[model samples]
Target chain A: MPKKIGSKTLLLTSSPSIIGYAAVGAKKEKQGPLADYFDYLSEDSSFGEKTWEKAETLMQKKAIELALQKCSVQKTDVDFLFAGDLLNQCIGSAYASRDMAMPFFGLYGACSTMSESLCLAAMFVDGQLANRCVAATSSHFCSAERQFRFPLEYGGQRTPTSQWTVTGSGACVVAPSKQAPYLRAVTVGTVADLGITDINNMGAAMAPAAAQTLCQFFSDTSTRPEDYDLILTGDLGFVGSRLLERMMQAEGYPMAKLHNDCGLMIYDRVKQDVHAGGSGCGCAASVLCSFILPQIACQRLKNVLFMATGALMSPTSNQQGESIPGIAHLLHISAFPNEKEAK
Target chain B: MTKQEYALWAQQESPKSKGLGDILRAFLFGGLICVIGQLLIFFFENRGAGEMAPVFASACLVVLSAILTGINIYDNIAKYAGAGTLVPITGFANSMVSAAMEFKTEGFILGLGAKMFIIAGPVIVYGVSASVIYGIILFLLG
Candidate 1:
């Protein structure tokens, strides 16, 4: 039987273990706060490829390779590969997975792809569908900018609300082994559109979705801010993070102590000059693999709630002046309560 | 907070507004592009290309922009220089090449060919039509 909790939450009975994680970032991401945490940093944004799109594909491939290497797992051992990216038709994942030679499930949740991939991967393992699977995602600033907003030479001015797309890739190996942190539960949120139309302000557009998912997760689990060691949002940046806090406070949920945004954490806002902060599929993916997962491995962060948010806006939709819809998928990761402790 | 209050708070938390430095940078880079164009024209004209100098110079500028867009240098320039890059013909070339590059993964005929004119298609259509209409008017007037 499926372990479906209230409305959108899923309490995974068979806790899937995150056996290993690998992170790779482009030039700008390498110069950020979590630079040291990344497994590899490419000096060349092209990743030795001529085009940005190809570079993103190489990045996803490299992330999966490195993660598999970390866990000493062979390609044949992995039952399935779950991957996605911000490219058109999710070419990054398809191209990467093609070379990987594994059964693949290509996904597209825009920036929320990390959590989405993880949520689905966890479900597969929890239901005894797979013994091992790899979840990976990538995003390139150049690729996303050209595809979504404006061409590099357009010289179009970016508003203050605009965020820099992060160029990075992150991958993780999920196994049935109890050697690492386990994914306890998942909360998949509904699409939220609060009538936000401005493409320059994705934080404002995605903030509502983050807030709703957080509220639903808390209410379903009957937990408080004290429950989790940290509650991290994917790439909401400064504006969306603060908006989420305010929305939670209105519901009497104090999130000040355990909340952080990966967008804001990636760069130094004033010094780096990343308006708002880093954002993209890679934004949360890189941060999780580079920073959060390592901290959890060391027992520094215990019970954590990670909410990856995505602003589902295509060029056609933006051109049609449709309101941007946001979606957030959350997962609960715990490093403690080891096999010994549980026994 | 109420909806209005939340909106106001979010706005307040936005990044720093554009400063005078941004305008100055944009102006400098924009002027630099024009200067490059002028220099190319001068070089070509001095080489005995005469009236064809301006044409070669513009073609060269567009080619340069397209290449830079490929190497990803034009984006950094646009980031700091802002709209200065877009005002020139080089910007249009960048759009075409970038669209082609982005959609190439979809397939050659459908992806690259279809999206190739996403930004420039309208301009070419209107440009040709307008020139033809002007020519007709001139002929009638004459």
Candidate 2:
């Protein structure tokens, strides 16, 4: 008889190191992204190097600490650490983890880092490789956009279908057994590109990928939208989420009633004035960590399909006029088994 | 189409055909965009993102409205709050993204590259054109 795959626990979580956000009153450089907004940087300091690195490192340290605190597990108890971030050469993550002093298996899934890390950590724990482990992903809005697209100094208008970069981070822990918090199922995705090329606005560009991945997840799990309490999309924002819903419906799989984008949940719509919703790796990661996890811990909701989507296209590819390629990873997170099951 | 026909088409295509409900909705949506932009101005200023708040916020509002429009929220809002959604940066964002998406299927080379100029194209053109005229006037005056 097959052993039942019981509840997998959430041991801890963390996000990409964070950079000091762009000041609100900065001047707009004639050709920079925020050159006109030059006055927003704090009086303490405007923009600088190492800020990104600093953000990434601090977040990682916090994640490790949080995991230790919540799970009451030692750094040494975590047999492996799976992490990723939107930094050149994964330097932010690798460098951050180096200080934590844990065995590391660094990954790169762009915005899909959360699911990537979670999936791997779940496998290790499920296989009984280790009693406890952690999975996490992090991103900084300024650092990501600067590296991927235009410099922060470049000032230009944005398209409506564009996604705002979220300036936050997220991290989470995973462990084997149906203890307290757990990962239920995971679905890896295939590549999907409707061949959109406008890199500046990622919502439209990555919508097809989100649609493809969600549809595939449903197929792989043979489940429908109602199967889970919430079909949480990682960062497909407003436009992408709509398109994903529409495409799924067109493809004979609709998710109209139960779908939400993490980017959409972060900022208050009336207050933030962010249009077309938020994006970036941190958008989903932060929403999951700060908002979603808290809700899950409180038992306000159950069975979350955390599908982190990504734009796999590089800047070189965009500059080359190639269609944007997209990917997604689906992680099924649920409450841990009851007291009886744990025993 | 003849010039006369084209002019008629333009007249018909103008975003002003709806009734008072539509107009009010647009105005309200537009005002909401402005309000959001204002709040962003304050938010970023507090956070010290910079004085570029208005410019960035305006641009972001346009894009946001455009996204809402693409998702059909802007339209529904416009239907009730008409120019409310149509007059702000959100409107601008809606215009650009919708146009870009329309032309995306044309293939990257001619479609995406060429169509990028569709919405922002006029802005670039008029911006450069106005700047050129302004330069000439300044040159003559100076």
Candidate with maximal DockQ: 1
Which parts of model 2 have CA positions greater than 4 angstroms off?
A: A1-50, A336-343, B1-142
Error of 1 at A149 (Å): 2.4
Candidate 1 segments whose C-alpha is farther than 4 A from its true place: A337-343, B1-9, B19-78, B88-142
lDDT per residue as tens, model 1, A1-343: 1388778888887777899899999889878888999999999999988788889999989999999999999998889898999988999999988878889999999999999999988888888899898989999998898778765544456788888999999998987876647888999978998877778889988988988898898888888889789999999987788778877888789897789999999888778888789899999999999999988877788888999999998989998989899999999988853335544
TM-score of chain A for candidate 1? 0.97
> DockQ score for model 1, please?
0.37
lDDT of 2: 0.61
- Which residue pairs in candidate 1 collide? A155-B82
Worst 10 residues of 1 chain A by lDDT: A334-343
For model 1 the local lDDT of residue B105 reads 67
Report the error of model 2 at residue B128, Å. 18
